[model samples]
Target: MPRFEELDVWKKAARLSADLYKSMAELKDFGFRDQITRAGLSIPSNIAEGYERATDKEIANFLNYAKGSAGELRTQIYIGMDIGYIEHETGKCWLIQAEEISKMLHGLIKSVRSRTS
Candidate 1:
């Protein structure tokens, strides 16, 4: 398998995390900002961590974690948009990107699991 760094899913996830941090850099709410950013960061981190593992099952577990984190980040984006921290257009884009990342992770998880099964 290619390294996680070479995976488009990982690259997109890392980009999403960076964009989220940039957009939230000036938010007045520390709690919300930190929580969302952490969730955003977790997606790519989990992907890389999973790829470093020795077994397919372990890799799949980490990919699942990344996918879950993507869902969490999408929820936060919705809340942020509703609360006026995020503009509707930006939030919409982020939602779409997050969904794409989640789907990508799901595919990776299934592929890895199949190797084990």
Candidate 2:
């Protein structure tokens, strides 16, 4: 299997992480800064970490963690928007990206699990 860095989903997630970081940086005083940014960072980092492990079960487990992080980021984004720290449209875009990344991670995990089984 190609390295996790070589995986398209991982690449996209990384790019999304960068984008999210840039977005959050503008809202430095946002109430959920630490939690939201960390969750966003964790999603792709976990994917890469799990992929580097190179074991199907390990990768799947990491992917699940990535998905969970995505969910956490999404919720935090909503909170930021609700509290007026983030623009509604900007928060929506981030939420959508998180959802997309989560689904992609889930699909990758399912594929890995099936191949191993």
RMSD of each: 0.5, 1.5
lDDT of 2 by residue, 48-100 (tens): 88888857899899999999998888888888899898799888888888888
Clashing pairs in 1: none
TM-score of each: 0.99, 0.91
| TM-score for candidate 1 | 0.99
- Clash count for candidate 2 is 0
Q: Which regions of candidate 1 are displaced past 4 Å?
A: none
Per-residue alpha-carbon lDDT of model 1 for 17-74, expressed as tens digits?
A: 9999999999989999999999999999999999999999899999999999999999
Top TM-score prediction, candidate number: 1
